[model samples]
Target: MNLLVRRLFWISFAVCGTVSLVWGHDVGEGDLKVTVLAKSSDAWDDKPLPHYPTGQPEITVLKIIIPEGKKTPLHFHSVINAAVLLKGEVDVHMPAGETKKLKAGESLIEVVDKAHWGENVGQGDAEFLVFYAGEKGEKITHVLHGDETPEAVLQEANR
Candidate 1:
């Protein structure tokens, strides 16, 4: 595991332990089923993972649900991110005409600094958790509306 992933695992472990203590339960006492869904140093498209941005490191985790038949506008992320599709399916489209269909229980190391979007291709809502590794005050996503840049989005976000 990389340093960043190790740190995140320890942090999550600490939190789980603390919560168990507070709730009068042992997190590891039950029939624990541990599984590694995905692990890679490259994006799903086989590109090498980019280096983390230098600054005060910050992590953002978001749970997004896209309703069936709904499509998100083209967007890009300036920071590194990974996601796990917890429910339903999504057809992810790249600007170069490449596409990937991610199903429930799958994971993906997302394409950073590239234009892409997703559409729900399942019978129900598509739910996923996206974890963004970035610096403090960094924008994780920038919606593209033809020729828009991340800098411009940041400027607009600050306002």
Candidate 2:
């Protein structure tokens, strides 16, 4: 019967619509998208990442907030680390005076056993997430005071 055929057609249409809606569309379809922000074995400074330490592996994630116009303490990380800038702009400087600038949504693989620091240069707080790979009982970050020199910091970090 005509009515029976019409019902089947409508049901098929509805099912197809539901399937498309649930599965969504791919990149070319413009319904969803993905991006590779960063991928590398070297830090932003072009230095190769250090070898993993021996012992119980530990992974640490830190959410750091730097107030506008403020600077973080000069410090060094003993292990390999990376970061994604979530908000505002910041400039990271190495003890040797080299600098790397970053803005919101940007990422950087950080230097290991090197003294460096960051300054929030934007109009708002600079926020970032840092991921560290290290071993248990090992200190990841070593902060240096105004009186401490970069050489001292590096020596401490290497030790």
Q: Per model, state how many residue pairs clash.
A: 0, 0
For all candidates in order, the CA lDDT equals 0.78, 0.78
Off by over 4 Å in 2: 1-32, 146-159
Top-scoring candidate (TM-score): 1
Clashing pairs in model 2?
none
lDDT tens per residue, model 1, 1-159? 776766456435432434444345465665554555566778877898777654667778899999999988989888878888999999999877889899999988898777889999999999998878777888788888878765577677769
Query: Worst ten-residue run, lDDT, model 1?
Result: 14-23
Candidate 2, residues 24-113, lDDT tens digits: the string is 665477554445456677988998976765566666789999999999988988887778899999999997789999999998889887
TM-score of each: 0.77, 0.74
RMSD of each: 5.1, 15.3
Cα error, candidate 1, residue 150 (Å):
6.3
